[model samples]
Target: MKKIILGIILLFNFSLVAQNPILDIHTADFANIENAYYKDIDNFYNQFVGTWIYTDSVKIIRFKFVKKEMFYRQSIKSCYVDYLVGEMQYVENGVEKINSLINLNINHSEIYNYNLYSYGKTNKDWYPKCLECPDTIERLPMSYNEPTNDDAGLEAAFVMHRADENGVEKIKIQYIETIGAYGIKPDGSPSITTNFTIPYGDYILIKEN
Candidate 1:
């Protein structure tokens, strides 16, 4: 009877562990520091280091500056001067869940150029999804051609679309990207933009702890 009870307890513990498997977030290995451009673009990169909440949806995004590293593939080497990591989370059915993760690589010379990578869990395993993907969104200084009534100095525009069996529609999310210098107005005033800018409407986000 004692042996049977011990076996049952061990089996129950194993079952519990199997049901809730641990996920490894740090599975990505970093290459040697090829080039560091954080010093050059520190001002631009610093603006993204914070927790941003989306008011339209239950989504929250946080960005933090990471180390500069070089990635190589197919004998091609590209240096990421200012590396920023972002995590996205949302609530579903009253349960908060991580939707996806992203790593951004910014060029030192072209502050607007950004290389993005999607990192998250796939089939219960963490993997880096897009590496040097062609689809990229850039932050450009507000051009005189694209005028806005709002007093914004910069703007980031990306053209995207959603496709279904019905067809597709051209969509562009152009809005006030950043405000002030280093996220503050020139006159020492505080101005912030919405987290997610969509064609349908602009949504506001609150900072999360």
Candidate 2:
């Protein structure tokens, strides 16, 4: 009896995709600073500052006075948050949210305060705040064979999250009327009746507790 053993070696030649060396260097720089911030307690002084705005039909406004907080060089990309006291304000009208406070479709003053936390670097301006911004609103742009502003189309979209001290991560909900309910949260606001009901242009960033 002859015993013959056949050994096959399977080699996977990984094609090394040559990426730009400068890209790695840039990433490393940000990453190194981020790591240091996480480890140091004193580094938790910066606030995760962002903007919030709202609109009805007549007026479009921005939190023009939103303050910019100091961010540690090491905290550029880390998931760290430092609690700093802050407040937010807005104007409302005869809407359900603010009708009791005042009447008429005129803008009124409103404010909310919260502790600061850090998220990753966000775009300086998510949606430019322009009162004259066109009504180019759509969850997804209509293409060749897609529905565009039919009766059955996506309505209001909202991003919700709790801006806590440790870090902002409790909930993030986008309300599309086409999907479900059409009322504001318990905290007195307009019942997001329809997609169009949401003021165009101004992005609403709800900072949770």
Candidate 3:
């Protein structure tokens, strides 16, 4: 009777451990993954801290980089955002006024991942389908149009590319804007629209002190 009671107790303890083995393993795995993810974010932020400039014959854009506090996973983290405070200066009707603008430092890979996971399609196939279409459709360049209420339509996009010319680290910035007029139809849709992108200027910006 004593041997049987001891055997039953040992078997019960072994079963308890076997039943929840995954819980013990995942606790350690999650800790290591979280540490690596934050480390990568910190390294990426350190690479993008500086001031950049772009100019044209008549206009100029000075982009200043600054770190801002953001809430992530119930904790505060530092991230970079373009703060236009005291950086943008333009003349309007012979009066100079400061512009306030803030933009996120979005990565191209993030955009690609978003489209891939959300739509389950590559960038080439991510588009509206027509009623009558061929079996195989050639991919076209990606374009987006934003809705507006003003008479003069507006479209804007930003492109960033890296450059290493003569050992000087630089980034090429293309900020394109299109302005036009559109006629509305009876169904509250754009009937006839004419648009063209005015050439502002593209610049290769270097890190400034």
Candidate 4:
């Protein structure tokens, strides 16, 4: 009997394609590999899974992330990718804002329609806050997009840890929303910058004990 092994190695130096964990793509350099199965090999996406809450006098929000794996991607090339699907409960200034916690299931094939989508973690040498006091820390990168608003898409850059010195898991996110530049708008104009109802800003969220 003869064994037949095949590999589909595609060299894409110009454009990124078939990257695992496509939400944030764990790899620093795009690999020309076979089968578009962007698996979370390092398990970086696991830390973001669970319920996180941030509260203050005027703002309160509870966010949850669920892992969606082996999801087929059709935006560019057809491939299975991994992503952290997010849902949230938001309120500001004593007024109820957005609450989609009731719809926190991870059965949706389309990741872009969710409140947040993230995959993998990365550490920056320039912004290494804790050089001496702790374990490995990495940032969770995600994007926020409200399904109804086409113009509202923001990049969520979050720095997270499983626990602190006091053993409290925390995550810090930037207050300002970084708009994603996919391309120009449908009318051939620039992409519009927009904010969300969720006071998604500079916040330190603590995981539920």
For model 3, what is the C-alpha lDDT against the true structure? Answer: 0.36
Give, for candidate 3, the lowest lDDT window spanning 10 residues. 113-122
lDDT of 4 by residue, 1-209 (tens): 12222222234422345343343257733223333667677777887788989998888888888888777666545666777778777778887777886666646667666777774566533132334323455666666655334442344344344444377787665544455544445466665545556654466789973
Clashing pairs for model 3 are none
- Candidate lDDT values, in order: 0.32, 0.27, 0.36, 0.61
RMSD of each: 20.6, 18.5, 14.3, 7.5
Question: Which numbered prediction scores highest in TM-score against the true structure?
Answer: 4
* Residue 48 displacement in candidate 2 (angstroms): 12
Summarize candidate 2's per-residue lDDT along 9-78 as a digit string, tens digits. 1111221212111122112343443323222233222222333344556543222112222223323454
Flag regions of model 4 displaced more than 4 Å.
1-25, 28-34, 125-136, 147-165, 179-194
Q: By lDDT, who's the top model here?
A: 4
Ranking by lDDT: 4, 3, 1, 2
Number of colliding residue pairs in each model: 3, 0, 0, 3
Candidate 4 has what TM-score? 0.66
Q: In model 2, what is the error at residue 193, expressed in angstroms?
A: 10
Q: Candidate 3: where is the Cα deviation over 4 Å?
A: 1-42, 72-98, 101-153, 178-201
Supply the global lDDT for candidate 1: 0.32
Q: Which regions of candidate 2 are displaced past 4 Å? A: 1-57, 64-88, 92-118, 122-209
- Between prediction 1 and prediction 4, which has the larger TM-score? 4
Model 1 Cα lDDT, one tens digit per residue, 1-209 = 99999999999988765653332222322222232111322233333344455433443432222333322211132333323333344444446443332423333443222222212112211111122223443221111111111323433322111111233221221233333324443355654533332222333343343
